[model samples]
Target chain A: MSDQEKEVTIYDIANKLNISAATVSRGLKDHPAINKNTKKKILAAAAEMGYRSNSFASNLRKKSSHIIGVIVPRLNSSFMSDVIAGIEKVVNEANYNLFISQSLESMKKEVSNAKAMFNNRVDGLMVSLAYDTSDIAHFESFINRGIPLVFFDRIYEHEKCPSIYINNYKAAYDITSHLIEQGCKRIAHISGNQLRNVYAERTRGYQQALKDNHVPFDDTLLIINDLSARAGNEAANQLLNLPVRPDGVFVANDICAISCMQAMKKQDIKIPDDIAFAGFNNDPTSCVIEPNLTTIDYKGYEMGETAARIMINHLVNNDDLQKTQSLILRSELIIRESSLKKGSKT
Target chain B: MSDQEKEVTIYDIANKLNISAATVSRGLKDHPAINKNTKKKILAAAAEMGYRSNSFASNLRKKSSHIIGVIVPRLNSSFMSDVIAGIEKVVNEANYNLFISQSLESMKKEVSNAKAMFNNRVDGLMVSLAYDTSDIAHFESFINRGIPLVFFDRIYEHEKCPSIYINNYKAAYDITSHLIEQGCKRIAHISGNQLRNVYAERTRGYQQALKDNHVPFDDTLLIINDLSARAGNEAANQLLNLPVRPDGVFVANDICAISCMQAMKKQDIKIPDDIAFAGFNNDPTSCVIEPNLTTIDYKGYEMGETAARIMINHLVNNDDLQKTQSLILRSELIIRESSLKKGSKT
Candidate 1:
């Protein structure tokens, strides 16, 4: 609320300099594209009008650190890195600092990271939940303090906070239906912790698709783990040992799916004939792998860009944060060699 | 320094509570492992002793915001993500924030990022240079203010700053030597921007290895580019069209090398039989790629951990950072089937 009262805005400085607010904002940050003289003029006007001192004084008084905290389950993945790249681009342009912490996929660490962010007084928070994070009690501190919180990708449903994600349920449904259309009678699903909505929704979609196609739902066909490479390899080994081998596998992620495919290949299984595979997240590995994995294109960078846009709007302008309850980006099944039972369609 | 003049440390609280410094620190942080009664007692003791207010006052005077800035060429690479993972682990443990930015391999962007980090007044800075960032002028502000600056991986020589890196020259030499021993008479080098010391050193080593093996260094054998996937593909195509096709190829990094190998495979070239390959960084892709690419292990995680430890030590205890001026981590060749020309050696 203090930001709404007696604070300097870029528009004020722009008006004084007879330039656009965009130019003023860029100039203040010393953006390289902005001419040096224009930047100097904007800086001089900002200082002369006491905007810098006033903003700094208010910031000190309110302890508004102008730092945004990001808490993710892990940062080593390609998808997470792409998301972070998009976030850093937007936040850095706005002259705000990003403080990143990883949960390493542990709920305890996630809670600790949230507490750390709260103690540090981050202006806003972005989160992607850990696999085992069932409780939302830890994030109450941010909600209670009215500090903006936004969730992306692997999110928990909170009434007050907004989330950015793709339509995982629909993506899974489409991929499973495609697999069935390709003549897969028995399909196996490899999933992550079913506690998380992302994996749970995908499972629901997979089951629904199977039922729609008049296939019997078999509990034995569903495999659950952390979606690790070892889990995938072990699942593949189990599938091979089964009396009726699964003709198709729809994995939760590309890494696990590729690992499983590789394991099966080592056993001399012919891809797209003896078995077919579909993966989620369309990771770079999906393309590099032999047979080119069929996958759902999860737009991580776009999701990140959207989340940062919403958070920055809420932070800078104090805009209504809930105009859009949920922003679900488009996701589609990308047909590739791995899942083409007969021949390449495209 | 003001921090030394009148600051209340965890040691003071620990002494008052008759506890270890670690317990006082963990208790104040609400660490889950500490019992509720112990944490409550430590909180009460700290409040009674005026440690909180005293420390806050000292922090204000010293302008210690407890944030560290990291500037890297890019973040999407597996090596970079690993490094960031290690840095986040250590800094988060010490309760320091990390502000990460990417230069996108542009010197102009690197300068801008450095300026932004300086303006944000990060307590310390960690940098991995962009390809063309030849000057240290942008970093003078941090050096002038006596802020601790540490460079890792793609670093430039600077007298005031400490650097952490693996021996790229030795790694490249060893890989090239192995290729020569594998009966590859004509070896090609696919390099990144020569402006970067990482690539430059590798180029030097490559030339030296060829000379050491009694093979004349041919200028035409070296291909230089930005090392993108497309670059790798195009370079492979060019290699095929060369007057004398190379029997082996040594790429600077795994992504490009894998891409090049894949491209070569599309042309029906037999790996390790017709043309052997070796790459750097031991990227996860290297293992996934067919024939399990022979590469150099770069140890990005360890490098990141070491850099963060040095920065935290200098920032927190004001320790003698100069004692360990430059830390060079270990690197070695990892031989796999991709370059095993004479079959299994081990």
Candidate 2:
């Protein structure tokens, strides 16, 4: 190896600062036994000498990598990004590094990511299930080995793994009810895969809302797809061509809702007049869209922070994960012009 | 350690399959010397026995972690999230794990993240500089150690480190010139911290375009802050209060530009008719906003893929990093209704 490739150690910093190696190590760790002035001098010497602490060696000895792994369906969405930001903030503040990867909403990729995290020996793992992640056998190793595993957002129900999520069922029910209160007799619904808890609960909520309002459930009004922008556009066309056009539309996500609304508008449909609209996940685009989208306002950042905090607490304080098997965060309905029909109460 | 806590090794898999440990290892690695049938059996046995390949041991022997580190200003933005998704795809395809961190646009946090990456012994590093990262000293260790360090988006000039970015100056120049061509004599510019090259170069481009078009550069028309949504709102108020308001506005980013446009619209200012608008980074919200914001369209996913590819090639194939000192990706001016003044040709 070249001289530049050589790893620096405590001895190198000690020699440069004319201090003992033990003192250098203590100073580097900010041990209470070390004097403040000496610690400062030691840190300066360490930086000057390019002496990086060997986390790998320490990890081997301590059996802890001080690294946490995060797996999400995708990173490009507004809600997911906010959640990641929240996770990063909490993880970084706790002096743990983050290993992040995306599943691209594929179960195959999620499985591979999980195996990689397991092989890397992450201190803890946080996951938001992929679109088609039916079986979580990939995560069984973590549970068997006593490594902390957490699920957020698109979660699965497991007795061993703790889950952090919003009450998707109630939020969906609230938004659907609001749309009904605006005098929409026939409401169309756009949702994602039924395998996932979020979409499944939302679909159930939409159905229950119609039943509670004494309105007959129409199977033709429910459109199930990937909940993508393109899908939303296609759903709009489908609804527009229906024999009996729906008076209201509720989407599982804001991105799809916005695109559907845009497509409807292009066809000369008036928002909240011809068709009232409501969506989930109060993405920034919801407010930017014309008439503003009425949606469920859930804090992805807060959900992320809560999930990370739970993992850190279990690892650091030996907190029992089972005590918080299911953590539900707060979410509310945000009514806007998109769902406000004539004579509707604000 | 408890029985469940004990790691499953190749020897255990060999014993279970009644095969030699050497053959088991070869089969597990899919070595050509092993028969296909044996390889399949070995893989099944390994999976059933919960045997995970010891990456740490292999990394020690080869002095390669098969890990890459990425640091960015923040992850909550549409562009950054797209970049991360792109990077994740490429890195995962190469069978290399990723260590991702956010600077929160703080130089202090950036320095610490760098140290953590160094300590973790990543094979290579990619960075998008923070808002206040004035000096490049923190990256010296990577350069000195011959570890490939690449910068994308927000970059710094360094002889050793290569960079991948779009032509910020030219893009800004083109957008400003477009605004001028729309019959705006006095255009306002909203930018972020000047310490960042992305913002500084943009400011220069805006000024140069004004000079070339015979539009006198007014210092009073320029607003520099964090370029946040709130800051954009404040900038709108300040510009609205000016004795002679700018006929056009060009913001460095879409989020800020959208918020500014909304603020002005609240004050009864008509877009394009009253103040033509152009913003950079074609964020999803840009199109969702009223009138559709005219901005620069650059593919963050492509930039991310390019950066990750460069690092992977240098690490895996021993490709020369110096051969590609600065790689400039493509960007285009997207003309939208917001910047289309009356009688202006599309």
For candidate 2, what TM-score does chain B get against the true chain B?
0.96
Mind giving the per-residue lDDT tens digits that candidate 2 earns over B147-192? 8899999999888888999888999999999999999999999999
In terms of docking quality, model 1 is acceptable
Collision pairs in model 1: none
> Candidate 2 regions off by >4 Å?
A11-27, A30-45, B14-20, B31-42
Query: What TM value does model 1 have?
Result: 0.85
Tens-digit lDDT track of model 1 for A162-248: 989988899999999999999898999999998888999999999999999998877888999889889889999999999889999
Evaluate all candidate structures by whole-model CA lDDT and list the values in order.
0.86, 0.92
Model 2's A-chain: what TM-score? 0.96
Q: Clash number for model 1?
A: 0
Cα-based TM-score, every candidate = 0.85, 0.96
- Candidate 1 per-residue lDDT, tens place, B1-346, comes to 2332233568988887789999988888899989999999998786554343333234445667678899998887899999999999999899888889999888999998887776566789999999888788888767766678899998877777888998888889999999998888899999988888899999999989999889988878899998888888999999999999999999999889989999999999999889999999988788888878999998888899999999999888878767677899999889999999855355
**By summed lDDT, which 10 consecutive residues of candidate 2 chain B come out lowest?**
B54-63
